[model samples]
Target: MQQTPSVLTDQLAVEIARLGIVGESSDIGTLHRVTELACQAVPGCAGATSIRWAIPSGDAGERPEPLASAASHPDLAEVADRQLARRRGPVFDVVEHRRAVSSDDILVETRWPEAVNDMLSRGVRCFSTTPHVRAPVLVTLTLYGVGARALARSQHAIASLLVAQGSAAMSNSLQYDSVHRTAVQLQEAVEARAIVDQAKGILMHALGCDADDAFAEMRRISQTRHVKLTALAQRIVGDQGLPEITERPDRTTD
Candidate 1:
């Protein structure tokens, strides 16, 4: 028995929701999965490709740069490559308009003759491009069909939903990476502070000086030796001795 469109949509939704779990996969992984699912979700879709484009900084006139791409089949990837290399096609048009672009038959498509020829040579007769925007990045999902007018307008909703879910997953993954880096930096800073305090205490006992005097001397030695304060502190704590410092000739008198 053939499944209804509603059933296929529900199944796709469930699959897409699984991608929302942060740290479950990287952005490339998500894009690959999305392309695979696009073929399954859209009726008559022979293959699918997902390309990620980075928005140009401070230059709206500059074209968006393609960062990565994932395709369900080699032919689909080749079609995308041709479009990107030529800098004109449904993908670029979708990005420019921030809307979906579709061609029911490439043999008669006149807007991008070169891209149309590429697609026809690859046995792709119909295609659609859908845009999904996440800040700093724009992702496009393209579905290919082997027969003319094979892709129906009804299938566009499924394609849009897949890219939307893929975008959310990517956003969560980026946020997780950012938070992990910040946590690592904070831990390193705490460790550095503890070691520096230990080094200062060692200085105070050996020099018979107050905390301020000990810190000042350590700072002077650190600056004169061109060593990082944290590195000098770690060395002092490890050896339990002050680093030798050459006194600068008193230039203040001159």
Candidate 2:
């Protein structure tokens, strides 16, 4: 049972490295995909991946969200998600509590009532979790098998490597997403300003007015037309081309 998955882990790493997430943003969806791969690498995994960080669960806030996962069974996945939301389960808490949780008999682990119940219902017998000590990063590596005692020592090592790479991938993805969003916003603003200026040019020529007067006129048209000044300017530059000052509408709603 364990022999095949250990080999698969090395093969999986080669495949995962080709994913090209280094020094880049890893989207939530990509993280989910990698987690699914981890589940697949292990023979007995029931196809579930959990990636969560330990946030300060205080007297006043809900726990963290399930950052990403791709589970084979939807119901079991929901149960795992809820456990994360509550901040009271083995996967996240083991890391939070700074302890290793290993159980051959999940039925007797009173500390994890909901997780144990969920595992039993899902036919998952042996569950083990190790705390990942990447500070301020609440990452835990989990390994479990259906109707079994514990993962082979080799399997545990394999799971650790998978989780480590997954963590790095997720971190890079977030950074890239932030940068991309900022760049898009900047581009949009620059484009909007360019349209406004072109509209201003058209107004100045058509109305035979100063730059300030042309802008005020554009704003007036925008308000009157119930459209953005940028849009009005774009229309002046693009479609109907800048219209006559006489084309400016009244700004009164009544």
Candidate 3:
């Protein structure tokens, strides 16, 4: 029984709503859900997997590997790993181009010969990969089929929409992580400032020096002892005598 495209779209929308809620809890959980949805939504889909990599910044460092992955079957992970090892396949193509790519017949796909052989060995006759673009990252959602010509060309739109939803959820997750990191960093900064101020007050009282002088003394001690300003301040707040240093050692060795 063939399902109409509209039905597939509606199903994808419902799944997306569920994913949105799950994504709020954990990005990994959302990814796993997407894999399950991919298998359920796409016609002839025997298995599905999702992979994501952070976009490289300056120097275009070693192409970042997929940070998260989910597969319908355990064996599919092995298949994905083999392709990842080779850095080739429909998934790679989608990541590289930020577009959707598919193989209607893996045995005859010339672009990724190694992946082709691997998928064939694993009974994956066809597969499709769609790019989910999230700034600083690109995710590839893939659906695997067990028979040649399993995916109809008409299904590409549906596959892409599903991937787009997954990408959106992933982007939200990334932003959430970034926000959390920023909050942590800000809290640390605030704590460090508070400690440094307290230590400065102590120095001002002990030496009858101005705030600037107290801060300068602490800076000098920090530089000479090669200790972090926060640690130095902590020691001062603890009423420990400032350690005297005769000379600074060179520490440029990698």
lDDT score of model 3?
0.75
- Clashes (N, CA, C under 3 Å) per candidate: 0, 6, 0
| lDDT for each residue of candidate 2 in 148-192, tens digit (9 for 90 to 100) | 664655566656666666666665555566889999999999999
TM-score of each: 0.88, 0.68, 0.73
- lDDT of each model, Cα atoms only? 0.81, 0.63, 0.75
| Weakest ten-residue segment in model 2 by summed lDDT | 1-10
Show model 1 residue runs off by greater than 4 Å. 1-11, 245-254
Q: Cα miss at 14, model 3 (Å)?
A: 4.0
Q: Which predicted model would earn the best lDDT?
A: 1
The list of candidate 3 runs beyond 4 A from truth reads 1-12, 18-28, 59-64, 105-113, 220-227, 238-254
Q: Could you report the Cα RMSD, in angstroms, for every candidate shown?
A: 3.7, 5.6, 6.6
The residue-by-residue lDDT of candidate 1 on 80-180, one tens digit each, is: 89888888877888988899999999888998888888888888888899998877657899988888888889879888888888877776677778899
- Model 3 clash pairs are none
Model 2 stretches astray by more than 4 angstroms: 1-5, 8-10, 19-48, 51-61, 72-87, 95-100, 104-110, 117-123, 130-141, 146-149, 152-157, 239-244, 247-254
Ranking by lDDT: 1, 3, 2
